[model samples]
Target: MKLGIVITHTDPETVFNTLRLALYSLRQGDSIRIFLSGKGVDIDKIEDPQFDVKGQAQEVLDAGGEFLACGTCLQLRKSGGSQICPISTLKDHYEVVRDSDKLITV
Candidate 1:
């Protein structure tokens, strides 16, 4: 199944867990796509307490998971504009939501 997970939080721990689940799903032979919205687009700029958030996100990418950061959200960030994850709009997100077999928000 194709699972789409939308991440809307800026918390490192929370983002860590969300990516963890994405990795797990990939390992289980499922396709996963994670979208960053709101403050969640700041993952590459913040410092986590214990986890390497960006590294974890890279791991997710390395493990064959896809990532999308909201275009408008990226533009709003003070440390904005990253070439790491591709930028997409809410229209793209809605199409993913419509096509996904399962949907989750974190």
Candidate 2:
């Protein structure tokens, strides 16, 4: 299954659970793609005591999962999207939605 996850919240639990699910899906041999937008873009920058955001995110990447950030969101925050793996525009998100078998928003 191809899973597309769009994370827009910055809450620690939300981020952790979202990535946790991504890991689980990956372990089950399912494809996972995570998109960070809004405050969720901070995942690569901030750390939660309970969850290692950047490290886990890297694991997702290492597993061949896609991790993209909203380019516009990054621009608004003055982040060149260097904070994450790749900067994707709304067009890219639309494509993801159209291609994925399942989509979830966090």
Give the top-scoring candidate (TM-score). 2
* Per-prediction TM-score: 0.89, 0.91
Model 2 global lDDT (CA atoms, 0 to 1): 0.82
Per-residue lDDT of model 2, residues 16-89, tens digit only: 77888898899999998888889988778767788787777777777778888898888889887763547888
Please list the C-alpha lDDT of all candidates, in the order they appear: 0.82, 0.82
lDDT of 1 by residue, 1-106 (tens): 9999898887888888888888899999999888888887887776876977888888888888888889898887644456445788888788779878999998
